[model samples]
Target: MTSDRDWTGRVGDIWATEWRRTDRSFERLAPVLNAAIVAAAGPQAGTIVDIGCGAGATSLASAQALPDGQVIGIDLSPKLIAVANHRAGSLGNVAFRCADVASAVGMHAPVDLYVSRHGVMFFADPVAAFAQLDEAAAPGAALVFSCFAERAANRWAVETVAGADDASGPTGAMTAPGPLPLPIRPMSRRC
Candidate 1:
């Protein structure tokens, strides 16, 4: 059985190789995606943590969006992080680190905002990882992320990949703000 570190290392290697060839395509989407995230999270004034920030596109965007804030983009691929750092040249408010967020140490604590661009889904232990994130976030800090939907919901990609399912399953909410129940769905009647 592979340990968490081993598993994450392998995953990182795979992404590093894949992103080296395709990172540019994702960079093209950063503007729109970053705009939406900045709009939703509003302008951050403190620190923002960008989990799995490949090539630092989102992190650079966050830094640009929040001039007063510091952005830290963490990923497990040193090669990708290198590219991210190169791309972030002269960006005083932004930095990228090559480390696995699931077990990464020295996270900037009391983070004002924690943003993940399709990052959390790859955690070997989602609950534990989020627990660490929850501890890192300040009280009332905002958390925002986007993940791919179910396989059936992404038929185009499935068909394009020759009917091979990537098996991207949902991890559900690991924790919620305050005492709110996970998901925070609407109720038919008042509780």
Candidate 2:
């Protein structure tokens, strides 16, 4: 399946060739993800930068939350960015770019707040990538991101998806993006 990661700009499809399951979940869970991001933005009264804007789900949410401000969602997927821009026609406050996170940081002006969800964790080099983002902030600006604690701290994954290589790329996959909370299916063991 394709993905927002490989974006090409088609509505109703973000990550088309990646994990089909993720695409399925993405459509259904977009609003919830938007809500979470919107809540974190907290009033959204300033420039909001979403590193992996991902088909504008978060970017659109940011635009709504920060009506007075602008939201720039940057990603490497042209398809995804195109879809975001097409959907964002004439909005004037939200801009989605088909650019790498680092490239966007270099070109984008310093902003009030910089926000990223699961994007940062996939960096080929986290320290270097973060340093670039760190440079793109104004004084007193806030940088918030959630990263994994440690493998030892969370093993439910290790036990459940053996050999899944959860975070591995060229370096490794043990890194945590965030401990995503799955909706549980209640069991009827006894009352």
Tens-place lDDT per residue, model 1, 1-191, is 22335434675566566765555666666666677657645655687888888777678888888888888999777767877898899999998887877556235887777777767556666678878887777766776665555434566644654644645533455332111113333222110
Name the runs in model 2 displaced over 4 angstroms.
1-44, 146-156, 163-191
For residue 155, give model 1's deviation from the true position in Å.
Answer: 1.1
**Candidate 2 whole-model C-alpha lDDT, 0 to 1:** 0.60
What C-alpha RMSD separates each model from the true structure?
7.1, 9.5
> Which candidate wins on TM-score?
1
TM-score of 2: 0.64
Worst 10 residues of 1 by lDDT: 182-191
Candidate 2 C-alpha lDDT tens digits along 3-76: 33323355224353333354455675556656655665566457778877666666776787668878888877
After superposition of all CA atoms, the RMSD between model 2 and the true structure is: 9.5
Q: Name the best candidate (by lDDT).
A: 1
lDDT of each: 0.67, 0.60
**lDDT, model 1, position 35:** 73
Off by over 4 Å in 1: 1-24, 27-29, 40-44, 160-191
